[model samples]
Target: MPIFTVAIPFYNDQNYLSKAITSCLHQEFQESFEILLINDGSSDASLKIAKNFRNCFPEKIRLINLKENKGVGFVRQRAVEAAKGDYIVWADADDVQCPQRLKTIRRFFKENPDVDICLHDCYFIDKEGRPIDKQLKWPKSFEENPLYFEIKRNYFFIGFSAQRAGLNIPFRSRCRDFPEDYDFILRALFKNKKLKLIPEKLSHYRIHGKNRSNRHSYTYRATKEILEGLNLSELSKMLQNSSCLKEKEISLAICELLMTKENFKEALEKLKNGNHNCFYSNFMQGVCYFFLGNNKDSALYFDRAYSLDSTEPSVQNNLGVLKYKMGEVESAVELLKNALQNKPDYLDAQRNLKVASNGRNSLSITKKPLRLSWVY
Candidate 1:
């Protein structure tokens, strides 16, 4: 088998699929690898573009065209099933991989036979392909656990946003959901698999209108679907024992997951003992109170949170909404303005501020922008 299987999950992406394929064809490793293209019912010219790769490199490319538009998740699942390389990697259609990507990952796997999955630091570029966004500087590497059992972030074996995580063949299952991407990586880690890291920035994560990160609601729904399928009790216990996370953070993570489902009551309960100062906890508590029409308590927690931290656009976001509802439009505008000033990339702040300001020239708030919580 080739040392790597580079899989691309694509839909109506004729404009970029060719660039992705050409990048794959020019890997720096100059070693054996295969490109498995999963075409998820593209109504555009994507199919023809992908097929052309076969004509150019018959031994290196294969295409799978589905009958209908199922979704990106399903497309990836199919590609994973078709992949034959000892190492399986996913590349989103619009993103371009550096020529050395395969060589870097391949070297890691070769040096560490125990490593099952590998990923490199990544950079984010704009829609115009400008390197004006995210820069990959992996601060930690995974070595604490047997690597196979550690579901980690920061440290090497950082949780693959699936930006790049490759598993050895004989894989257990395909990722059929959004949240499943996170859980799937965890499972792959523990299936007697280890993960290695390539610190160099070898991938460019293209951020554009159709990027899944932009569709928070759709991604969250997929996450809900996948999370609901897992054995929470079993998974929770498994997480507790793994090297992937420490106790407090994992519990907070579980609570965060529950909050996404809008199980606010359960979320609040789970967070009662959570040590971390989670803005989500305060936000969920506010949500629970808001739904109950306990505006006073809701306001109280939101105020406390706003006072505690304001860096996270989410907190400032909630605080702004609360202020607006409380007949403090001016205050809401100020809060959101503060949020925007802190992080220009925050959509919630920009959206809420524009709506609240109604074309106002300025928002006046004296408080310094607060530090944001790390999680939503």
Candidate 2:
């Protein structure tokens, strides 16, 4: 068996398929590794490109052709099941891997037998394969607990792994629009799997028009579904006791997950049960109350939250909405302006400001129950 299986899954990526395959073929590693190319019923020329590569290097490459166009979740599950290597390394069909990627990952896994997952950073490249000015890097706090960082941003690439391919396939029928990689990583983390980062830009991630993660609404819904399936309360307790996260951070994380599912009362209960008296706790409580339609308590909590951190944009925006509801137009306008000044790109604040500035007292015109910064 090969030491690594470089799994590349594609649908209609004829343009970049050859480059992606070639990058893997050009790996500097001295050990044997197989490149498993999966064709998800593509109508494009992607299949021909994959076949030509396989014919040229039959010993190093293999191809799997599905009769129907299954989504990425299904494709990934199939890849894991078919992979013959001890370690499965994922390389997107449109992305390019550095020549040293496999060598570095192999060395790490051989030295650290206890680690289940290994991740490396990537450089962002435009569709033309030219390097963009920016590279993606995980924060240092990721070393504390990868789950917390994953919740904040799905920053890591689906690169090297020592995980059992059969585990956490994320092939749920309800999670049709979910991020399969995010789901897989979260599942592994929840199982107390050890994750280590290589801190190297070992891959080139292509930013193109066909990227699925650009659909914010669909991504949000899918992420919500994934989070809902997990035992969040239990996860929160685990993080609270062992991870580097603070009490208020854990409470806010749980509240964010609950609120996204529209469980306002449950979120409020979580906040109330926690020993947190910080700004995030008060802000989340206010958001829950607002969503629950208990405007009086909502305003009370928003006021307390504002007192703790007056410059916070979410607090300002939420308070401004409450002021408009209470017929305090002038105060509402001022708070909304403050929120805009602090965060110019805040869509909720901008919308609320527009409505308030127009002398619109209608609650339907305003957006309320804005999430605090810590939630993301």
Q: Estimate TM-scores for all models.
A: 0.73, 0.86
What total of clashing residue pairs does each candidate reach? Answer: 13, 0
Lowest summed lDDT window (length 10), candidate 2:
366-375
Task: Give the poorly placed runs of model 1, Cα more than 4 Å off.
Answer: 126-130, 137-183, 186-196, 242-247, 273-284, 310-312, 323-337, 340-376
Which pairs of residues collide in candidate 2? none
Q: What shift in Å separates residue 342 of candidate 1 from its native position after superposition?
A: 4.2
Error of 2 at 41 (Å): 2.2
Predicted candidate 2 versus true structure: per-residue lDDT over 1-376, tens digit per residue: 8888899989999999999999999999999889999998899999999999999999999999986888787887888888998888999999989999999888888888888788877778899998787745456688678887676556545643435344543433344445877787887788887888877778888989778877766876677777777787678767887557876677677777787678889889988988578887787788888878888899999899899989988888888899889988889889988988988977778888887778776543222334333212
Model 2 stretches astray by more than 4 angstroms: 151-156, 159-176, 240-243, 273-275, 307-311, 330-345, 350-376
Q: Quote the positional error of residue 80 for candidate 1 in Å.
A: 2.7
